[model samples]
Target: MKSQLLVPAVYDFLENMEFEGFDQFYEYAIKRDVPVVSKAVGNIISFFVSLFRPTNILELGCGIGTAAKYMLTKSKANYTGVDNNLERIEVAKRFLKDFNKLKFIHSRVETFLCGTDEKYDFVFVDSIKKDYEKIWYLLKPVLTKRSMVIFDDFFLYGYIFQEEAEIPYKYREGVRLIKRFINNIKNDPTAEIVFLPIENGIMVVHYEG
Candidate 1:
């Protein structure tokens, strides 16, 4: 979900930054209308991975492994990706076959989170916006203050800030839910949230609990 909110020059500068082979996956996602993370967003996530150098990485709603590729490019951290779509999981596994430290789980995020006791030091979530609250709740059990979690498309292509009437019918409810989720996070004493206006609003979260 690319953002149209940036000025022309600023947008051009960011888009011009090279992610080398990432353009291929970006083009593939565009052609199929899949909801993969934008290269700019993916780059930001990669930046964090390089900085944190986490031992374990978890990705929810990993579509075709685009962002996973970016994050894993400079790091040797063991990665786990969860997606409910079996077909996409297969595709991701094939696409990222070179990465021996990674595994893709074809399971609903709720089920996977509930079943796993392993905590991840870093997480990237690009799933359904409306289900973010539930996902966040499930994630708390698996996150630490040192963990960095990034959620994609929180702005919903700029719809999250629009009036109820301004938003398209299909996205209005999801946008509302995201706003509520943000507010709840803001009120929580044990959680920290930071938003980056990079390509449809990326929310970075950490749990201090």
Candidate 2:
């Protein structure tokens, strides 16, 4: 299978934005061959976390600490990021070394969920969508009563529940799964679900008090 290629033009356009600390981080990531969060997505996440300001944050599929770095700079939350990719984890570790409170786990979300005993105030899900329900089930036992969960990449170009558009297949399937996941979460008596039209799309579910 062929690996995904970086879109230099897209990156360049996003790099032109005037977000504080973003340029430095972007430069660092490029120089070190790390993954950088898309500027659009980064802005959306920064905005969401800035509003919520959760004390503890958990991130699934954190690629090279782009979002983690942004969260540390933009919000006060202590963050723990997880990704199954060891090389990405290594890059993330070095990229985020300056932040004492930020931690990266070199494990799959499934494996991490199985062994972790800690609860989080905020959980950001951006990993494989096929594992959405499984990840939710695993996290349910470790989430605070009033914790918030954000599901990213739930929609691409504003179409929901379509799995075969011009976008990536995984992304298409992810959108479909997220819709189902949101519906289920909304119907759950213990949670309130809200969708944010930012960063492809973010489904924010808050466990009821």
Candidate 3:
């Protein structure tokens, strides 16, 4: 449901490549209308992982492990994926059972972040838009100085830039929160952030300025 306003032919160009083992989950997600990371987003994530080779990876709101497939394939890092939905977790586990060092947990992103003593070098979050700031506050405790976090759907299908009345009623609040987050992060001295108008748009951040 991305607004075609920000989308150019680039997404179709970059997304034409095949994901050998991910097609099944991708089809399932699309057929079910579940929100999964776009292939363009997955590609950038893979590029980042290939560049950094982080030892530990974490994904918040990992729906059906679509993005995790790209991440685990690129790096040998132990992958931990968290989602509040049990059904999605089960399906993700079933789809990703072949990956040896994978762990999929059924828990809220904030709860998992608060409880874990783990440190991740790379984190991808595709969570509820309205909960971004709330989860963000709890998420910082789990990262080290070198951590890189990528938050997907920052543009919310291009409705973020639309007039409030133009955006669908259901999505209006999420768009507002994204605007709030963009401004808040920009003003924070400790955060070095980049917003890329990729598929659904992504907000990339470094934990330390």
Candidate 4:
């Protein structure tokens, strides 16, 4: 994907904003080539967490617990993160060990979602685009009333709007799936969504149905 900014001026403004203790984990993630939430994305999560004050938060594809940490900083909520990456899960466990209500489960999103009977007040997803529809459908039974779901990388690094021929072979499938996911959510009469042109794109969904 190209390096075109989704919101160039807004990114420039947020780039200057300081994240006090996040630099440590940020640097570690950079060194390990692990994808973590951007400062702006984290800030947005913080905003919602503070605003909603959800009692139970679920995070899909939590990488190294950066986003979880950010959310915890903003609000005191019980958090559960699920991912298949063992190494990343380990990092998350170690990083967030001090947080009493935090838990990290090393399992696929579908596995955890299907097996658990727990309900969540909020969910943040940063997982495979192709599995998003399946995940959302499965998540329905577990979501409380007026729950909000935040999806990251919805713009697919600016490739979602491009032609299939223009996109690389590997990214084509993901782009298509994200488009389909967005379209499905948009057409769903029970859903309310707002698209934010952030670092990549943050799609916030409120399931009213």
Error of 4 at 180 (Å): 1.6
The alpha-carbon deviation from the true structure for residue 117 of candidate 1, after best TM-score superposition, in angstroms, is: 1.4
**Candidate 3 residue lDDT tens string, 71-186:** 88888999999999999999999988888899888998878988999988899999888888887888887887778999988888888889999999999988898889888889
Instruction: Extract clashing residue pairs from model 3.
Output: none
Order of candidates by lDDT, top first? 4, 1, 3, 2
lDDT of 4: 0.86
lDDT, candidate 4, 1-209, per-residue tens: 22255456767778568987787678888799888888888999999999989999999999899999889998778999998999998888888777888888999999998999999989999988768788888888889988999988778888888999999899898888888888888898878999988888889989775
Instruction: Evaluate all candidate structures by whole-model CA lDDT and list the values in order.
Output: 0.86, 0.73, 0.85, 0.86
**Runs with alpha carbons beyond 4 Å of true place in candidate 3:** 3-8
Collision pairs in model 2: none
What lDDT does candidate 2 reach at residue 50? 86
Model 4: ten consecutive residues of lowest lDDT: 1-10
The CA lDDT at 67 in model 3 is 93
Candidates by TM-score, descending order = 4, 1, 3, 2
Clashes of each: 0, 0, 0, 0
What TM value does model 1 have? 0.93
Compute each candidate's TM-score over C-alphas: 0.93, 0.77, 0.92, 0.93
